[model samples]
Target: MSSVRIILNFLSGFGVLANIFLLVFYTFIILCHRPKPTDMISCQLTFIHIVLLITGPDIWLWDIFESLNIDNDFKCKTTFYINRMMRSLSICITCLLGVFQAVTISPSSSLLNKFKYKLKKYMISAFLFIWSFNLPFTCHRIIYSGAFTNVSETKQMKATKFCSLFSMNHIIRALILTVATSRDVFLVGLMLATSAYMVIILFRHKRQHKHLHSLSHLKASPEKRATQTILLLVVFFVVMYWVDFIISFTAILLRMYDPVILSIQKFVMNVYPTITPLIQISSDNRIINMLKHMQSLCHHIFKWR
Candidate 1:
């Protein structure tokens, strides 16, 4: 129960609350307006985020649980299970969105134009695949996932390491790292490639048409803006992810305190999920307008009642 653990838990708890508040607002607007395809992607991402907010990383009711100073084996397994599932799914969905946006914005003559047509046609299948494909990998968490008798006063859940005592843990850790790093590297590369191509497309469009008032320019603006947002997201992901990876590897090498490593990773991972809705709000005028209308509707409804 170090001060660092307490502070990290408190911040995670706050982040969970913030995510919930913003999600409610975003959900209200989306439901009222009827979500478009891209909005549905946002909705899917947000849905995975509910698990993120309420489970893992000592975020779910952290203050309440920490004060009681108790954690169970069942709770640890369940939390980490959902954490593994949702983390995998979120990254998959994010990569999909990046690819979708890239293809959707590509010009008719571009090679990626084929993907624009196929993406919508295949999006449902893609989603289904994401769930089914990750199940096996996520289930692998069962090997070392469990609870501890020694729950610290500063923390409710002792960070469980089922493999820490085993000589075989190294082999298992290597396998886990291999699977995880391979997947991450592939997705990250896809995002970077798509982002770079999309940027090139945008610049080409601008160069071809210097006139901002042209019909093509107006049509291109929203696409470019959304793609740019995705690129920003990709940038953020790449930077934070590498930082976390390095820290995590170093922590393992040096045998750093579990709480310190947990605290660092928790803060690092939560950054994107916490702020994603705000990113959508800033980039999407449609959502903003819908929110405005929803606010007025609610105001009227309350007055009528």
Candidate 2:
């Protein structure tokens, strides 16, 4: 192992612990508040964060323990395929969240408002659609990856190896990459469009309700904050998605299977999942109120002393 990889592993190990803590925090918030109908997407986002943290960067951290008692190909393929599915699913959920919020704030007379009123009713069905859609696409990953024990190293190292089955067939490998890219592009495009539309609506509302914004700035603040929070999340997700996409394209098309490229891609992918929970807590009114109360309680106790 290189010094760089060792350092990366240590950092991600610590992040894994932090991610677990934040996962519990968000889960508790959802449980306590019983998320509102509009907030259901936020709850789903929280759960997706939990899924990604457990399966993303932690995969590398846990790879060291793989036992080659037998050819553990089954475990490797299963774990790798599941991780891919989780990563893809998280993106889909994010796009869903953007659309959900966009429709939510649309004017009552607009077509989007029609979706707004009905979206909460079909939240579970929408999630079911995401599952039914992305899960099947990731089945291709199982065909592409498997467990392999490398004998080149003195100690046997078993890891989930990708493109093992089709490494020799460049054309099929390219086709697989093309299909995955096209799917993501279409979905991400929707995310971009929705985010843009949401921004436009917010901008128009601010212009139309300037008096309301000034007279009851407190009321306007929460709505603006919520919209900004969702928009910021979509923007961050877009940056991460594009970075991963470009790296993925190079890694697949050019077969630039360098450790550095793989590590970079994995790091970018892991960063969002690990950090998203904190963002959720920041946006959550209930969680913020709880924190404020706890702060005052601690201060009062210390002051009494």
Identify the candidate with maximal TM-score.
Answer: 2
Clashing pairs in 2: none
Report lDDT (Cα) of residue 57, candidate 2: 37
Candidate topping lDDT: 1
TM-score against native, each model: 0.79, 0.81
Model 2 misplacement above 4 A: 1-3, 6-34, 57-72, 149-165, 168-175, 211-215, 301-305
Q: Which 10-residue window of candidate 1 scores lowest in summed lDDT?
A: 159-168
What are the C-alpha RMSDs, in order, of all predicted structures?
A: 4.9, 4.2
lDDT of 1 at 186: 97
Tens-digit lDDT track of model 1 for 1-305: 66765665665556566556656755776778665566667677877876776675555544445577756555566677788788888888888888888888888898889777788888889888898998888775555656544333323223433212112356877898898889999998997888888789778877877866767556646667787887787677677778877877776665433756766777777777776766766777776787799999999999999
Candidate 2 scores a C-alpha RMSD against the true structure in Å of 4.2
Return the clash pairs for model 1, or none.
none
- TM-score for model 2? 0.81
